[model samples]
Target chain A: MSMPALLDLYRVQARMAVQQQLQYRMRNAMVLVGFLTEPVVYLAVWTAVAKENGGSVGGWTSGTLAAYFIVWTLVRSMNVVFTPYGFEWRIRTGQMSASLLRPRHPVHYDLAYFAGSKVVWFVMWLPIAAALALLFRPTLRPEAVEVLVFVVAIVGAYLIRSLLQWLIGMVTFWTTRVGALFEIYMVAELMLSGRLVPMSLMPSWVRDVAGWLPFKWTFGFPIEVLVGDLGTRALLLGLATQAAWIAATAGLLALAWRGAVRRYSAVGN
Target chain B: MRALRLIALHLRVVAMYEMQYRMNFFLQLFQSALATGTGLVVLALVYAQVDELRGWSRPELLVVLGVFTIIGGVLESVVKPNLVRFMEEVADGRLDFVLAKPVDAQLLISIRAVRFWQAVDVLVGAVVLGVGASRLTPRPGALAVLGFAAGLLFAVVILYSFLLILATSAFWFVRVDSFVETFDGVFQAGRWPIGIYPGWLRTGLTVVVPVGFAVTVPAELLTDRSGWVTLAAEAALAAALAGLARLCWRLGLRRYGGASA
Candidate 1:
């Protein structure tokens, strides 16, 4: 597809997603509320710990901790891509056959659909963010450049997660054990990606390991852009790293799609 | 007694069905260990920074973690599967079959399904609890054990009532699939002692969700921090919640427009 045609496809798919998602706003709101509890738990724990430790632990005061997790809620919502389980379902139900018949890549459709849903999620997230801010009193103040970096970084985080998860989803073509593998991936992300806590709070070895992996770029980097006081040079470096992960994962996904498609023997009607 | 027999019958069928997928038990073990390991590491990190967490020493906090796992295991293995099934049935209008059963509809619905593999978490939790108890300078005595047993009984009752009340909401709204996820997220708070939270959230966890009562109160009994008065209060709360749940279930039943009706 030409560039304009591809853009049009994304526009149409995203519009459709927004329409479909809006119909179930109540359901989505419940899920969003469910998402809120995680950060609240984390915030409450870390704040208590920080307070007990003479008002700081590993350079994270209670206010900054609040900002990190509150921003975590948004970054998490931004990076909610299509999961590997969905891929397993699509192939088992022969939905892949319908998708393959399309002229464009199937990933584009998913990318657009989830992007559209993010629009609705962002709207829903506003009231939630406000409530958290009021309760936790998160101390978030970003410069103009940091604000610019955050916007680019979140988009980068979204693309990187989407492509990597799509690559993981492609594994369903070979085996049905993707659930176990996905759980493993999630644990690694939880520990290494700064999802559970800030990297500063983690041991140095964990921080060093996280630097090499793509998980940090998806979660910790984008969140730190707005939450932490990273220097301008470090912020640019993080964005560059996010771009590199996006490129590498997209390239790997393109290769994996070839093998996955060839291996696919469509199942359900 | 009839409820016990019904649960036993369901367990037998679940066991036979699960025996075919024996490898899944190993998978569950691995996942449960991974989760438990992560919890321990977080505790390590927390304790590394301070001697105690708002009067909760590391080992005392470990007891809380263990109780959290055990309660979570019970919920996932029995309560959650049934609750999800109930919600799905409500949404699809298949609940008529359940309501027509010979046994009490509430009892039947609550005991219908079990994920046998998920019970691995209970074993994992017991092992953690044993290790935590062993580390205490003065180990827990028989009185502590008795209190723990009673606390656990009340905890399960309260947790089950909470799940039933949540499931009963399906009768009115018909779709609350995300309720399980929300519950899981909120339940994570029980990993820490309820005392660590602010006054308002602590009260919310205690009364609104009762996660504090379900996990922390039991752990406190094991650690000799709570007395019989607390246990008696919990017992009363459990009875009241059970009554409330029954009332809610009956009221919801009146709203159930069955598929065939």
Candidate 2:
């Protein structure tokens, strides 16, 4: 497909996904409300713990902790990958055949849906985030350069997360129990991603190990830019790491897709 | 006697079905252990900052973690499979067959399917509870043990009832799949002592979702923070919610009309 033509096709797919999600407005609202409770849970715990510790524990006053978790929640909403969970079901039900018949690569169509849904969710998330900001009063002030880095990091992180999830979804072609495999990955992400706990506050061993992992780049690096005074060097380094991971994963995905197609063709459609 | 026989039959069928997936069994073991480990590590990190979290020492907090696992595991293993089956049946127009069955629909739906692999988590929880209980300098007495048992039973009832309420939403909505995920987000709060949260959030967790009653209050029973009044309150709330959930289920069923009418 030509570049402009391919872009137009993706645009149509994105529009379809957005319209489909809009049909379930009530469900989307309920889920948004439910998700809002999570940040409050974290805020409540950290606030109380900080109070008991004479207004600061592990170098975090309540305000700093609030800012970190609130931003973390927003970033989480942006980075969530839904297509991977659906990929297995799609392949099993013969839906992948239709995608395979498409002119452009299947990943573009899926990416369109993914990005489109994230846009819708980001809009839905705004009001809840505003209310949390008022209630928790998080202290988030970003410099101009840091803001630029933060935007780039969020984009890079989302791509990395989605690609890794797509790769994980390939396991569905081999086994029906993709959920079990995903759960193991999720536990690793939860512990390492700095979503469950601030990386600074984690035990030394955990922090050291998390430093070496890509999960933090997907979840933690952007928030760290806003929440901490990470210098230009570290910011650039994190962005570079994200780019490297994204490139590596995309290449792997292409190889995996070729192998999957060959295997599927050999099995008769 | 008939119910016991029915439950045993269901358990056996589940075991047989799950026995085919030995790979899944190993995956479940790894995943469940990883989950438990993550909780323990988080607790360790929290204690590294503060000696005690809201008057519960590290050992007592481990009891909370254990209760969280047991309740979550039982819900996933026993309650959730049935709930998922019920929702799918409703969606796929199979509820008519289910309704036409001679057995009571509520009882049938409640115990229809089980994922036996999650029983591994129950064992893990029991081991964690035993270790957590033993690690305390002064062990809990017989009364404390009795209270833990009562509280744990109430927690299971409350959790099951909550699942019923959520599952019953399928009667009105075309898709209510993420309700379980939302419930999970709320339930994660129970992994820690509810006492550590602020009053409003503590109240929200207690009344809105009842994670406090489900896990923390049970943990408190073992830790000696739960008084007789708290235990009584929890019992009353569980019975009330269970009643409410049954009423919700019946109303939803009436509206559903066996997915055919």
Candidate 3:
């Protein structure tokens, strides 16, 4: 597709998603609030630990930890994507066969739809963020360059996570019993992606491992861009890393997609 | 007595059905272990920073994790599957068939399904609790063991009632999976001692959601940090919530308009 056509396709799909999701404001609000618990729980635990350690642990003070987690809620909202579990249903129910008929790849639909919903979630996130700021009193002040980098990084984070999870989801083309595999993936992500805690608290080896993996780019790096003290060199390097991950995952996904579509057999027809 | 038999019969059928998928047992076990491992790593990180959290030592906090896992197991294996289906039935108006059953409607809905393999966490949690207890200066005495058992039972009741109340709201809204999702998120907070939370959150976990009561109180009882008075209060709270849940179910049923006419 031409660039203009692809942009138009995204625009249409995103608009559709926004319209559909706005019908369920209450439901969306509940889910948004649900997303708050994980970060809030992590924040409280780390803050307590920071306090007990006499004002700092792994260089994150309580106030800065507050900033990290509060920003965490926003980054989390941004990174939501089509779950791999949905693949089981799609393939088993012949939904994948229908998607295969489309001129454009099915991933575009998911990318656009979720991207549109982020607008709603971001709007919903504001009041909650304001309320959290009041309660936690995060010491978050970002430079203009850092703020600009963060905006770009969050979008990068979304693409990296989406492409990677989509690649994992494609494994359903071979076997339906992918639950255990998905669980293992999630566990690794939770550990390495800075979902549970900052990577700083992790041992040096884990940090080294995370640096090699794409997990930290999707979560820790983006949050740190706004909240942590990253030097100019590190900031630019992190963005480059995110771009590299996006390209790598997208390439792998393209390779996997061809094999998956060939392996697919429609169930009812 | 009849309800007990009905529950046992339903569980047997579910067990037989699940037995056909034997590999899922190992898969479930592997997933549960991974989750437990992640939790233990979090504990290690926390303890790496401090010796205790709000006076609860590392070993004591391990007990809290065990209780959280066990309660989580019960919720996932039994309570959640049934209530989620109940919500869908309410939404689609298929609940009339349930109402037509001879047994008590509430009991019927609550015991209709169970994930036999998911119950692995109960055993896993017991082993973890035992390990945590073994590390103590002195093992929990018989009295403490009894108190823990009693507290855990009451905790289950409180948790069941809390979910039941949420499920019952489907009668009014016609769908409440969002609330269930929120509950799942909130329940994760119980993995730590409630004392560590800020005052408002602590109250929310205790009063609004009851996860603190469902996980922490039992853990505290086992560790001897709570006494009979706490257990008594827990029992009273469970009974009151059970009563409230029953009332909500009755009220919700009256509002239900079946699809079939």
Provide the global lDDT of candidate 3 against the true structure: 0.91
For model 3 the local lDDT of residue A88 reads: 74
User: What is the Cα-based lDDT of residue B28 in candidate 1?
Assistant: 96
Q: What is the TM-score of candidate 3?
A: 0.98
Model 2: per-residue lDDT, tens digit, B1-261?
A: 777787788888878988998877777788789889978877777777778777888899888889889888998899988998889888878888878878788888888798888878998898888889999767888999999899999989988888889889899984788888778778888888877776777788888888766898888888887678889998998999899999998898878855454
lDDT-based ranking: 3, 1, 2
Each model's total of backbone clashes: 0, 0, 0
Candidate lDDT scores, in order, read 0.89, 0.82, 0.91
| Candidate 3 ranges beyond 4 A from true positions | none
lDDT of 1 by residue, A1-269 (tens): 79999999999999999999999888788788767777787888889888998998888888899999999999999999999999989988889899999999999999999999999999999989898888888788988889889999999999988988888888988995488888888889989888999988888998998888999888899999998789989998998888889889988988888988899888888
* Candidate topping DockQ: 3
Residue-by-residue lDDT tens digits, candidate 1, B1-261: 998998899889999999999999999999999999989988998888899888888888888888889888998998899989989998888999988889998888887889999999999998888788788757899999899989988999999999889989998988787777878778888888888887888999998888876898989998889999999999999999999999999999999888964
DockQ of each: 0.76, 0.53, 0.87
Per-residue CA lDDT of model 2 for A22-117, tens digit only, reads 887777877766676666766676777788799987878888888888888778888877555798777777777887888888888877777778
Worst 10 residues of 3 chain A by lDDT: A260-269
Instruction: Report the error of model 2 at residue A11, Å.
Output: 2.1
Q: Which has the better DockQ: candidate 1, or candidate 3?
A: 3
